[model samples]
Target: MKPELENIPLVKNEEKKRFEIELNSHFAFIDYKETSQQISLIHTEAEPELAGTGAAAAVVEKSLIYIEESGKKLLPFCPYVFAYIKKNPEWKRIVDQRFEGYDKL
Candidate 1:
């Protein structure tokens, strides 16, 4: 199912080589490799109250925009991200080249 994305704040600290956001004070970020132009979704979690609020999708969407702008691909290691890709076929283009594993899910 597509998530109910809202009020998401995407932030990046390039100096730290990471991009992140706050969901009820808890943070999430995507682990990436600049040279290979690949991003691995490292982790994501929200306060119990924020669960199912689409905070994960919002963070992923923002990161995808960054990938598109940087001419890179995404490695959705996190299961939530993998599921998001399945729901949003339009975002297939930015999917990582090695995403063969997702076809089974």
Candidate 2:
């Protein structure tokens, strides 16, 4: 059986500027940089063991939720995050307006 999303604990490591979740013994993380009004998602990675486990999406979802709750705009420079937002347009409301029409890129 697959693990429930709630079972995974996503943590924001402010000192590392990343959101992290543990899978097995490895860590999956989404790297980001924050300013007063915006947060730029720069990268995302998960251990090979976590592939196909939905761990990446879980972390991204949790991170985006946090950003929304914090009232910060998101700049998804990371391809994975960009793609995720594209697929989940409801989350686009929190995206930086400067990135409007980014799909054309």
Cα RMSD to the true fold for all candidates: 3.4, 2.4
Positional deviation of residue 88's Cα in model 2 after best superposition, in angstroms:
0.7
| Local distance difference test, each candidate | 0.67, 0.86
lDDT string, candidate 2, 1-105, tens digits: 245766777799999999999878888899999999999899999889988888888889889988999999999999999989888888888888787556533
User: What digit string (tens of lDDT, one per residue) describes model 1 on residues 51-104?
Assistant: 766665677778878778878777777777677777777777887766776564
Model 2 steric clash pairs: none
Off by over 4 Å in 2: 1-3, 100-105
lDDT for 46 (candidate 2): 89
Cα shift from native, residue 28, model 2 (Å): 1.2
lDDT of 1: 0.67
Q: What is the lDDT of residue 83 in candidate 2?
A: 89
In lDDT terms, which candidate is top? 2
* Model 2: per-residue Cα lDDT at residue 25: 84
> 100, model 2: CA deviation in Å?
6.2
